[model samples]
Target: MPDSQIKFLVVDDIRENMVALEALLRRDGLQIDFAGSAAEALELMLVNDYALAFLDVQMPETDGYELAELMRGAERTRNIPIIFVTAADRDERRHFRGYEAGAVDYIFKPLDPVVLRSKAAVFFRIGQQARELECQRDEMRVLAHHRDIAISRLKAHADNSPLALIECDRNLTLRSWSKGAERMFGRSAEAMLGQRIAQSGWLDAEAAGILQTWVDGGTSAQRHSAEIDARRADGQTISCEVFGSTLCDLNDGNLSLSLQLLDVTERRRAEEVRSLLIGELNHRIKNTLANVQAIARQTLRQADSLAGFEQGFVGRLQALARTHSILSDMTWSSASLDQLIDEQIRAGTLDAARLLRKGPTVQLTPENALRLALSLHELGTNAAKYGALSVPGGEIRLTWTYNDELLVLRWEERGGPEVHPPARTGFGTTLIRASAGCEDDGVSVDWSASGVIWTITLSVGVAQPNQPDQERLIEPAKIESGRPELDGSRVLVIEDEPLVALDIRYELTAAGAGKVDIARSIGQALEAIRAAEIDVALLDGNLSGERVDEVANALRGRKIPFCFVSGYGRQHLPQGFQDAPIIEKPFRADALLPVIHELIRR
Candidate 1:
């Protein structure tokens, strides 16, 4: 007899009959689960995979007919075959009714154990065949997709007419050369086809030696690059950057090499002009920095005494430091508009109390965050010194909106002593606008007697979806002793943080884990999985700097179920890793218990 791995669900109101059927099926190497009612059976089906279900036709609430109908309604359990175990007489009406209720076959009591085993074997074989065919279809689909992408890339390269395309065999025999190659080297494919490239007239003595060394290796698998001057067919020398690398067959066993030759003379000449301009720009920046530093020193030195210097020089330096801090927060790039305003306004100060900030979340890339932060600093400083924030009962409102993909941020102030425009342009205005200049997008400001208003519109990248919170389900009014059965299975805990690892270990043990093993690293986790059978695992996304996906794959390879517990958002989770239960960081113990039991039963 062949060993069978098919699982069967045994549903019956009578516990004795269920046990008898289980005993009979055990001889055939079938794993079985016994359910007292159809509702219990359906709940089992939701989380477990069984080749067939032996459902009793008549039972308490939700008999086999109602149970089968519900199963058919659910996408996850619709495919499981149902075999009716009933005492219904052999009437055509009852037979038709059973078929309508999604039963594959109906059996009468007193049951024949031998006949029941034979019928189940047939459906089990069918399920295995269906699974195998699906796997094959998926493999073919992946192969076809890769082939299409390769063909598309090849067409793009061919149509663009790159500087030169060279194709050679294992022995350095020229097989194909493109038109661009002919124009660059003054040699046609018709003249070079089927000829040894070493015998070609292009290479000089030193180049020939290098080419021969590469050819002696059958084919140079790694890229070989060199800049060399070679005489064309007309005896005029041209400088080219030649690169060669091997290509392997996508399907069958075959190998070849392709070389590309690029003409870089024009680009090299342009680099010289760019270098001169860059040097002049650098010198101008240095000169400007020196002048600004001298002016700052002069302003402080001309003050009456130490107290004046502290009041003048120290304030400006602190403002500069605040701008620098905001820039650093953005990694020296753009900062979010709201974050800029919040950071520049001291919490206990009038600027903070009078400020009103409202906007959707927006992120500035490094350069923009810094510029926006500096501009925001100037606004906050001016308000503190003279505008709304400087007076009692003053107010400021900052609002932003996204209209048709444009990010518009507004800074409006009011409720201060009647405002007035500055008598003359000052360094504050220069620095504020200069910071905005870092962005290609234009920035505009309006200074009014009532208040100062500034608005800037810039492009912002779209945001990805946030991780979904746990689903809410209605629990049974009162759980009977047999209410929802928690799985009594082994669990593995893989977390590098010792505190987190111990917490998971304690919870699993309290949750009735028969055996719980803790692994702090990827290597240990794999070893634990291999040495002991695991029913479920709770893994951290970063275990010894390795992704939890690696642990997931190992569990999948063994047909074990596992869930991830990560501080990182679901977006950071590896692909194909989400469907399995994920408990986000700071999850409660109660939430994890249900998922563990669900996956375990699966």
Candidate 2:
């Protein structure tokens, strides 16, 4: 074979070995150089590039490892493939060390001529391919840089042009607007971008409605034009032809919306002046709606009682009012979900632990928030009147989270009067499921007489990620009945309910209590405990005559062990005393036995 392309370096203490390696590789079209030691190899490499280096493992002053490390440290020869020529057994540690020091492969001292030639040829082709790829990458980088510069220039020209250009995302948040938009909208470009066009005063109600008509399923990627009025930053309204189109980039496949404002002030002002009569017609229509509601309310009020009216007109009016209020608060744009929940549930007074409100923490755009709040208000009003929060012995907990892009909120009731699910769907239910003006499905309210649980999910664009728990607001764990076992100890029962007092006496007798006393009022209970040797007292909260908390204080003063029995919930109890034994009303006999025993056992 002609020695035309490949290059190789041979290093060894013996000149005869270099000659033999060079002769063997010459058959593969390789040019060979000789170095008698590592120092000579370093000198040759500094001046030229070699495809492969054959280093003798047993050099005198600096071995193959030392020489390979030197070549690897030099930038030019760092990646040159090294082959360690050695007679040492492959299992020897130093022979392995030679490979670790950057040797590509190992060759015994009596090198096989064919094996040497093949290895050198392998590295030469690899090096040539690597150089080619590096050149291609550099070219791609140059092309990308030029593309970015072209895009930047195009955007700058678009911004400086006279026509107002507005770009918005799917949710209608302005993503980009040009200098012309800033001038026409009476706002800075920086202030307008990322703001909703409606909020930035770029389009009036009529113009926005027309634009929305185009935005919803108009010919995809086609321009739409209509004449309407837009508002400027100075609060001055101008006549304009609003042009809108869906933008689909063919190369990148990104979907966007583009809106353009062509000032038709002189051409359209005459038309708008003539259309002032149309604005009056719209106002009349709104007045007609209010008049209809008023008439409905007046007709419903003719009934003898308010219940019929509440179901018919009042509920509808409240829903409408809530919607209006929410719209006003959001400036008719969007409402925050958290703010709506806070407003509707403001009346619930359960302890932080008992009342929990958790969710995605994203603000609902005005329309969704308004509809959801109206539904939740109905749920809230019903709970305030008859559900868990209505009675003293109840609790309501609300929590929500976003799972898989779906928003779900849950209301759980506990420690409440026996619940029976709502017998029939009422106005509250209808308002919840009403899909009148919202993109989301209607509210879902699950009403149990025990309490009302409601979940409202509306797609309000993209949902937010789950937030970490703000603070653990869970109810403290109930203190297990610390009541000692009665163990024949004297027990006192102070209760206002005659039947309940008699029942406690019966329970204590069954439990083998030595003595039992029942008191209907705090005064009587106080006297009985003072006069008797009472080991344990089962006190009833809400005595006919006094506060049960005061009775507890007196019992504690007397060093008497006492547990409370009441229909009241944790919410009704005074703060800082949740740990006390509180047996819920209508508890079973077996439950009472444990408390009686546990309290007196001590």
Candidate 3:
């Protein structure tokens, strides 16, 4: 309303006088209202606010004098300034009457335009000043209201934030302690405010010194953050992360800081545990890899031929893998004895139907379980080849008994070919004996007339031997009744992994093969075949991830008698090599001997 037009009222019985006065007063931001009689002027005054009123002294019926009296009587219209419009020939009594009737001044009938404007401009200026003052008052009221709301919102944030919010001067005198801060230190705001920061006793002497130094450094927000062990009101020590910043209030000449702290005790503990687990994992991995490498070397040294070496070496690796799988399932703590026996027998491809096992539920530590698995696999394979399991009617009874101090496992055979002691100890015999790790009473094999009887005795809950000594790696007497026909046969081995290729070379050379050649990729294999005459070749089913059919075709064209060696079993054989004799990885020398002999005959 103050910003709208400034209006003024003019009351006159004659239209000419009113029109002339209205024109003089009318300008930008000013509105003039005209009325012919006292009744009309009173009505105009009641509905609108006017800056100035000019009334005629002489009028019909209800005159200007009566209107002035009426306006003065009413509360809404009393404050408006009124000037009388009169004739130039007015008597003194008429002038007195106008003055006494509440008219501030009089104007003549023959008006002076410049004089009229000057007088009316005074009242208009006063009205404008009053409106401006009122507007300024309203603006100040709004600004005060906003300031109160802002303070309330800031207080709410300080009370409800998850982090402890503390405000202090650079000298470390506390200024504000939020509800969050109170909860963290177990102290109330009233008790904390105005006190020195360390007075709350939340930190130890050393921790307090560190925090004081940091505050003195005048670091910006989040520029200085640290983890410190702090004490709570209950005297419990906890890890806390402190973050702070210097406030931008340099004009006050006193520096301040806003500090926030969060509890990180659980997170620190978790990190410590994770680091220990990583170290343990790394140590276990390195040890396991070394053990496997040694097994491969020992198996190769005693193998009589490539075929035998593949069989023995692969079987040992499989046994170790299966044992590790069970140990992993048990978190490497212990393993079930029944599970170890079942896995080793199945992996050796032995006839479980002809065997019976009777034992109470038994659990062995990880180390003992590994050794026992290797021994069981060897015994199973020997029975299938030459002892009880060779005949369908033969049966092997395995039984075990364990107590607090000792564990005894027995293997008995019946209804098979007559048994007799071998001429020399084989690798399997040495392995099972070493696994026993006993001098007086360990492992024994009785070549009884009915079948072979094997028994292993071990100390329960005692440390077994970690690994067999390399000096104990015996070169066994040949298993073949007659010397292998491959005596001096030149052989080519195609395998991708370097260690596996070297193992194959060792076995073939030991088996009386002459000048064994090795190739990794298909191109290298084909080139080797062209450079020399190869009597027989062992083809890897897969080179990297691809089928090695192209290299097989080259061998076929050369009329070389070769067999497929695949670790993935028959399902993964090279497409065109289906007609070739195939042997899976990890075969015993006996299994490979027949494959090589068959190829030689072909």
lDDT for each candidate structure? 0.70, 0.68, 0.78
Q: Which one is best on lDDT?
A: 3
lDDT of 1 by residue, 333-378 (tens): 4455555555455321225556666666666665455456556766
* RMSD vs true structure, all candidates: 32.4, 27.1, 11.7
Candidate 3, TM-score vs. the true structure?
0.58
Better of 1 and 3 by lDDT: 3
How well does model 2 score by local distance difference test?
0.68
TM-scores, all candidates, are: 0.30, 0.37, 0.58
The deviation in Å at residue 360 for candidate 1 is 72
lDDT of 3 at 1: 33
**Model 3 misplaced stretches (Cα beyond 4 Å):** 1-28, 31-164, 173-196, 219-222, 230-240, 262-267, 327-335, 345-351, 358-369, 394-602
**How well is each residue in 426-536 modelled by candidate 3, as lDDT tens digits?**
778877886666555688778889888888887864332333212111122222344365778888999998887887787677777877899889889999988888888
Query: Which regions in candidate 2 have their CA more than 4 angstroms from the true location?
Result: 1-52, 58-63, 87-93, 113-129, 218-221, 239-244, 249-254, 262-602
How would the candidate models be sorted by lDDT, starting from the highest?
Answer: 3, 1, 2
Encode model 2's per-residue lDDT on 1-602: one tens digit a residue. 23234567889998888778777777444567889988889999887667788888888999888999888888988988898888865677876776677887888867787787677768878755665566788898999999999989988877786678888865577888788777776788787778765666666666666666665653464677777887777888787776788766679765667877778887666677669857866874586486446636553645346655544354444444545555555555566555555444332223344566655566565545645655666665656566666776566677776666666667677666666766665545665675334534535555565555666565444346356634234443333433334567888888888998888787778777888888888788889867899898887768884677777777888989887787655556544555467665555554577766666665
